[model samples]
Target: MNNKLHGPLFLAILSTLMAFASLSTDIYLPAMPIMANELQGDIELTVTGFLIGFALAQLVWGPISDTLGRRLPLFIGMVMFIIGSVGCALSTDIQQMVFWRVFQAFGACTGPMLARAMIRDSYTRTRAAQMLSTLLFIMAIAPIIGPLAGGQIIRVTSWHAIFWLLVVIGGLMFFSLFALPETLLPENRVKISLANVFRNYSMLLCNREFMRYTLCLTFFYVAAYAFMTGSPFVYISFYGVDPQYYGWLFALNILGVMAMSLVNRRLVLRYPLENLLKVAVTVATIATLTLALVVKLQLGGIVAVVVTIFLFFSMNGVIAATSTTAALDAVPSSLAGSASALIGSLQYGSGIISSLFLALFRDGTPWTMSWIMVIFTLSSITVLLRRGPLPENRSSLN
Candidate 1:
């Protein structure tokens, strides 16, 4: 292994490319209220559109990245993102903004899927998990800083400036990605055939263990999405907190995730990925259940709810990083990108479904979010633990 090729600098660059999606999503959240007023539409509708666009775009970009090489697709996605940002900045109507948002999200999906594929391209399961955790430690900055930045931007100028900022970030990411070496070697590249693509997907679909592990991560994401979608309402509408304060609350969860990611990076070398996942899922389930109990009992106030959700989300970083490594390792290197695509499609698919459900159940109360989190977390735990324990090294089994 070349030290220069896999050093922290490369990881940091890769993480930034991957975190672009999160930044695009979260950075715009603080502006949602403003966007609604400016566009003369309901705030909830605008937010839901953004979530749907981002989630659905993942399904398209993931397979495209797998079929085409990672680089070209990434470059194209960046260009599209930049265009979308400009369109958003210039939009005067809600319909036009929604269209641009969908366009923007089409480009945002490339980072996470390809970043994971690149890790599988280079490292073994445990090392891949560690590398993912390291990348996440860098990626965590998007959620922590995106809202704060958006708030400041909104305070100084209009929400349009936020879109312009994304335009700059997208352009920078486009050039920076050129420096990343292609990790999917020609010998390991899958043929871009419809038949082969379907065959590969069928094979993955038939694997019970793969589905179980992937769903575990997906369910956790459902909880996360529920929090993202529902929390603003809970904090601002129900509890009467300011939007800036909500950004700080969101940043607290990001901090928890970053802390757990650091812990995962350190422990992955010493422990089996499966054992770590088991522990993480167990902790997350317990935390979610505890939160549900607190909400049910009306224990404290908004503070207790925030603390519990933060703890639940903290375990997600570890579970997601490990499960992704394990799932990608199940396939041959030739199919790494496709495998990553499927994992992402499933994860965000769950997110889309959960977000919609939360929206439907939303009543400007914290209980709705808490109950949904508990249900998904418990279901995930049941599925993951039902198959005995996860294998020590998933790649060896493959």
Candidate 2:
């Protein structure tokens, strides 16, 4: 049962599935202000609703994927995504839109969480990192094009049209999954029992290395969510940049991720995953602190801000792939699905908290945003330093 499909084809399918999750969030970002105006509600509240919906749904989907197997949950998730997109398109009120967005996120979680687990099931640590880098390289195109596409869609049609576009993408992905072979073996599958669920979760929770990497990854997401929630306000309201211009800024930052991911893919073969993660964390800490200082001093304009963010997000491309490979490597075969669930929950759970903090401290100032990123980056570095380095070989974990 050599389940390893052609590398390029596997990557293509994985990237498409993963990109659907992100496209659902980011493609509509440029339209947030528009959605607020149309729905007759505060933009912040509407945005918060979407984030909340997305984060909360992760808990349910992960356990389901672990119990039921990857393919079915993924199919159900895609269907839910399509339905949510349709619901969003038909929504007439903010509350209605919020409900549908929650529905949407529930579906979106299937790909990112399960996809990582699937990669791990098929490949070793170094190879998993390589595959993820390639998958991320393709998935990176989503953020680059999503906002731009959404912007153009908004420019030409109503915001509802964006949801319609999501519906179409979801449909395509659903059809594509029909050809995607199940990567998780039956011998490895866990039955959906409450006691078994808690037992597996306890195993993950008690592992020092798993906790360390999960926290490290979570903090990184916190930093990202902070910037994402604040950047539009900072760029548009304070700097007087038009919303459409944000597409280019967003695209440029993603390009930075793409560049770093390619470099990491090459470097992972020579340098250890742990070493790469350490370097990435260190660079990210410095970049984030620099961003904070620049904002405090009011040094430069949008270019400075964008460049700093680009550098910050570039680190994410490396750290995310590294931490994922590390976490998945730590899991025993029997608990791989549970391990995947816990990691996904931690990452999105941290995002939920970070988004809350961003909302609370939002004074419409760049300083507030920078401070949040600084806090998250420093926290992640602190966790990694305490844990020391990751084990060099996956075979040792077994």
Candidate 3:
């Protein structure tokens, strides 16, 4: 049965699942202003709640998927996503919307966390790395498609339409999983106990190499979250770009990231993935620092800021895809779910930090986001490139 989960079919399942997870955020982003008024909540707070839900959900779901096997947990996830989406549509207040959003995020998170675990289940380290990139490359299309479609959805209907679309997507994924075979074997399964879950996570936390890649991935991820959280207001309010045009600008950065992922898909087999990741981290650091300087100097206006941002985001595909590959590859196969979940939890934890930072320090200028990106990118570089020979984690693919 697992053999059937081998090729394009498997990629499609994971990408579709990931697409929905991504859609849960990307699609809803453009509608934030309308939502602020109708749902009666602060835009930043709503976004923060949803992202926090999205990240925190993985902590529990990952271990559950590990304990129960992928199928039951994933099935439960899809159902919850549907319910959450539906509940969100019916919400009359912002609080209700936030609650439903948290629920939806929990369900939506199953996609990426389990997708990584499933890849580990069936593929070797290098192949798993390549597969993850390919999955992300496919998932990358969602950001382009989501915001564009979301903008159109908003023009035609209300923000509630976004949730309704999510409901339909959730339904399709739930039914689609019928064909997804259980990838985790009985021997690999662990007991579903609280102590066991903590132990599983604590082991990954203790592993220096595993923490290296995971934290690096998480820190680098904060820049992306900050951009998403802050860009709407920056573009719409500060730059005075039309809401419709904002998605295109957003899509431009997303397309750059996608292009890099495609490049990684080609190079991943030929180069040592870790080396590629290091190079990516280095490039991202420089790009971010340059962006920060540009903001500090107040040079080139919004166009310059956007250009630097695109460059900064372009590294996302190369760094993130490669780092995730390295992180999971470094872990023992048995702890893949736990490792993936912790990675996700930290990833979103940084997202929470990014949101709070934006809320606290934003002064109607892009300087704050620029410095924040620089800070996070530097953190990743420091984690991954400390002043010693890097510890050998996985055997070299090249």
Give the per-residue lDDT of model 1 (tens digit) for 252-292. 99999999999999898888777888899889888888888
For candidate 3, the TM-score is 0.94
Off by over 4 Å in 1: 42-60, 192-195, 392-398
Model 2 C-alpha lDDT per residue in residues 1-398, reported as the tens digit of each score:
35346556667888887676567777877887778788986555544565566566665665666667789988998999899899999999988887887778778777787888788777778888988888888899999898889888888899899899989988988998888888777766776684556567777899988888888898988898787767777876788778787778888888988888899899899998888998999898888898988888888877778888988999878998998888878767666766777787678656666667766877778988899899989999889889667765665221
lDDT of 1 at 138: 86
RMSD of each: 2.4, 2.0, 2.3
**Winner by lDDT between candidate 3 and candidate 2:** 3
Model 1, position 295, has a per-residue lDDT of: 82
Candidate 3 residues 3-51, lDDT tens each? 5776577789888876765678888778887788877767677667777
TM-score of each: 0.93, 0.95, 0.94
Q: By lDDT, is 1 or 2 better?
A: 2
Supply candidate 3's per-residue lDDT for 42. 73
- Model 2 spans with C-alpha error above 4 angstroms: 1-4, 191-195, 396-398
